[model samples]
Target chain A: MMSWLGETWAILSKEWRCELRSRYALSTVLLFAITTLIAVSISVGPAGATPEQRPLMPVLLWLILLFAATAGLPRTFVHEEETHTADPLRLAARPSCLFCGKTLYNLTLLLVLEAVVTPLFLVLLQVEVADLWSFAIALLVGGVGLAVGSTLIAAMVAQARARGPLFAVLAFPILLPLLKLVIDASFVAVAGEAQSPALGLAVLYDSMVTVASLMLFPVVWNP
Target chain B: MTIKQKTFRWLLFVWLAATIWAAFFYAPLSQGFAGKMGDAPQSSRIVFFHVPLAVASFFAFLVAAAWSGVYLWKRRSIDDHRAVAAIEVGMLYCVLATVTGAVWSKVQWGAYWNWDPRQSSIVLALLYYGAYLSLRGAVEDSEVRARLSAVYAVLGFVVAPFLFFILPRMASFSLHPTPGSAEMDREIGLVVVAAIAGFTALFCWIASLRRRVLDLNAEAG
Candidate 1:
């Protein structure tokens, strides 16, 4: 088990190192996120929504995250293909471990993005975070779930002929439940409602999905 | 006639008899909503068949995905053909399920399409698989198409829980009633179960036929 953990960690670190050196995925994801948010804000209006209705801010924030993830995530795998790196990586480690590593790496990147964007979202959208801890916790749950789902989906779509646009279309319906949970949690966090049940539900979703993906990825990433 | 063909014909006959008997007598008619249909006689009859067909279609999809996984894991060409056959059969069932569900929903909910979670999710499934087949057609090379479709199939499974399970739970706005045997009542449940049995048998039969068809196409070409 520890050896497996080491393998997973090694793969995760390798991906992180690769991304950091290139700065490709983070920059594209961030650029897309910022541009989408600006478009959303403009489309919604400069004056902004009322406070009572401010709960919608989290929904909007996650939507931006969703679109940004959709737009930028395929690059994560495509880079691998372009470099012809996945072949070597697959040969060295178990495919299952590789999937775990990739998922963790993707999840971490999303968390970093959320970490940076959440506060910015709060200020720009005029969302009152009743409890900062709970707010972050909910986003974390949603982020991890989104990360696992999108990472696998992005890998799948990246292999297809039309990489970028196909990823968005394919990922949207499948990620609807996670988006719904995120929207609901965001509502609870903003409205100062009891955070326990909503947050708990999101966590349950994350755990179930994470475990399923871990087991399923071996077959999915079959060489 | 050969024994295999005889057995197949017998199975087909039994399935047809079971389906007809179950639909008419075993399953009781559910009363439609108050005004639109006005408690019309024979209105609740469709529920028995509709629910069963939808469930059978879902079962076919599960089989398709599982087969696709096997194809990738074993890296066998035949498994790919099996997966494709199951998906095609599943797609047929899915269409019938949607049409029946829509018709049933119109009777119960006063709308032809209620953005109800179950209805919406079924539509999503249809669209996802539809796009999948389209992708299969668009790509020319057999190996490439197989590889790409296998990936899409696996990804489709990953996202399924979110659409079918999660969104519906989260959507407070949906008017779709809670799912259960109780919703349909004992009489309805029994009929639906019988119909489901019939549909399952039919699905297997159709899958075998489709497999043979594909082989024949290959031979002819």
Candidate 2:
């Protein structure tokens, strides 16, 4: 157990070092999110939207995050495959550990993104999150859900042709339910509607995806 | 085909044809299947075909997921063939259901697309298996494809319940009519039940035939 944690940590730190050196994924995702935020704020200027359309603001924020994640997160595995490092990494670490570490990296990356973008989204759009608790939970849990689904898909996508588009194609449908739940959660946050089971469902979505991915990642990551 | 197999095929053909005829001629077009909501009563005949196709498609995907689980456990190429065949048939049925529902929607709800919860749910389900097919297409090696696709199939099965059930129901109201509402005609109900059974059998027979063809290809190549 200790060895498993150590192995996972090693793989995670290896990912961090690689990211720190290149800033490839971080920069790509951040730039995508920032650029989309800019376009959204420019066209749909702060306080420009009517009250009828205001309820959709948080949903738009999530859409930006979803597209940004899909654009960049699959590189976690695709990069390893591209550089021919996957085989050695497979040999060195257990499949579950590799999965855990990669998912950890993705979760952190998404958190970093949300931290940067959410405040900007709110400020630029002048969107009032009436229920900050639900909004925050939705971001955190929905981000975790994205990380888990994206990592498994990244692993699968790495083995396939046209890795870039296939990652989003495969990941999007699986993430749809989570996206629905998150949208519901954020809708409440935007509309000041009464709380719903959206957060609980999002958690359920995360756990189911996480457990299934953990069980199956070994098989997917292997021959 | 064996004699019994031929006999069953003829029976299914007759049964389904009768179902279609009855759907239009025998089943009464009630006042409103959607009760007060005013979904076109004549359009409600779509339930006879649409419900069956939707149910069968959902069932076919589950069967594929089961076969995928079998392949993962046993690592048989035959199981993979079965999974792929089931998905292909499932996709066919899913598309049929979508078209039928869309046409019915246009007649009943004044749009080919209503963005109804049920419609989105079915579309999401279609994409789930669509991704499975694309995954199979992208991989060159048979064994690796089977293994990786099987993992995804199982993952999808786990998520299927929430996708099919909870998320769709989260909306306060869906424009799609509920099946067992009290105002629906009993005659319509009977035909729907019969059609559902008939279509499910048809789906299974077609999927098995496709599976046999796959098995033959495996042998030939």
Candidate 3:
């Protein structure tokens, strides 16, 4: 078990090293995120927006995060296939180990994105959270759900003909339920409602997707 | 077709015919406001067909997921054929259910698309299976397609309960009736049961026929 985890860690570090050198995924995702945030902030200009628009901030934030994650996460596997490194990687690591490594990398990338985007969103949208703990939990759990979902979907579509559109099309439906929960949790956190059941649902969604992705990744990875 | 298969198909056809007759002729109109629509409650008749299609779609997904699991475990081409066949038929039923439900909603609620939880969830389900089909089409290799789609089918199936059942219930307000809230009269209930049974048989027959056609095409190729 220790060796298995070590192998996964090695693969994760290797991915990070490659990413650091290229900075392709990170830059693309961050650029897209910042652009969307600015556009939204300008269009909905923090001060002039009506009261009805307050509830929509969470939805907008999630949508930006979701699209940004979709833009970036597929590179985890697609990069390997694109550079013809997939074969060597497949040979070197067990399918499960590779999945673990990719999933961990995706999760880390998403957390980093949230760290940057969430504060900016609050500032730009002038959104307030009554319960900071609940809001943070929502972002954390929701980020995990998004990462797990997109990582598995990225692996599935990595070898497909239309990998780009296919990734979003496939990931959106899978992520809808989790997104709904997270959005609701965010709404509640903003509304000052004693942290609602949405947080529990988000946690449940995260665990379920994480487990399902782990179990199903071997088949997608090998094929 | 074998004699047994032919007989089964005939029986399914007859059962479906009877269900249609009973649904229109025998099932009592829904009570209250639904029964009062257009002075004759003709719109309520949609339920006899609509609810059964939804139920059958659910069953069809279960069939697809089951066959997918078998295919993954055994790697049989026939199981893959059956799995995709069930999804195709289920997609048809799901679309019909959505259209019929929309019609019913327009008549009952004065709007066709209410973004009701049930309505949204069905759309989500359609997209989920639609993605599966797209995935199948996108992959060129036959074995790889079968394997990957099977995995997707299994994973999608595991998620279905949460998508269809749990999430919809979490919505605090919806126009659709919640379970245990709407009471069906005995006659309508019986007709609905018959319609469900007929639709199940029809789904099975169509899926089997689809599998045979797939096998024939494979052989020819």
Which candidate number has the best DockQ? 2
Model 3 chain B: worst 10 consecutive residues (lDDT sum): B32-41
Taking the tens digit of each residue's C-alpha lDDT, what string does model 3 give over B1-221? 68998899889889889889998888877774454345546788888889899999999999999999999889989999999999999999999999999998888888999899999999998998899999998998888889988988888876887788888899889987786687778898899889989988888888888999988887786
Report the CAPRI category for model 3.
Answer: medium
Q: Backbone clashes per model, in order?
A: 1, 0, 0
lDDT string for model 1 (A68-157, tens) is 777666676767766787678667898777878888888888888887777777767666778777778888888888888777766665
Candidate 2 residue runs with Cα over 4 Å from true position: A46-48, B34-40
DockQ, Cα level, model 1: 0.32
Q: Residues A79-196, candidate 3: write the lDDT tens digits.
A: 7888899999878899888888888899899998899998998887788778888889889889889888888889888878798999888888889999999999998998788647
Off by over 4 Å in 1: A1-21, A51-55, A92-97, A195-198, A220-222, B10-28, B32-37, B69-75, B131-190, B215-221
Between candidates 1 and 3, which one is better according to lDDT? 3
Please provide, for model 2 over A71-138, each residue's C-alpha lDDT reduced to its tens digit, 9 standing for 90 to 100. Answer: 88999999999999999988989998999999999999999999999999888887777888878988
Q: Which clashing pairs does model 2 show?
A: none
Query: What would the TM-score be for candidate 3 when compared with the true structure?
Result: 0.97
- lDDT of each prediction vs. the true structure? 0.74, 0.89, 0.88
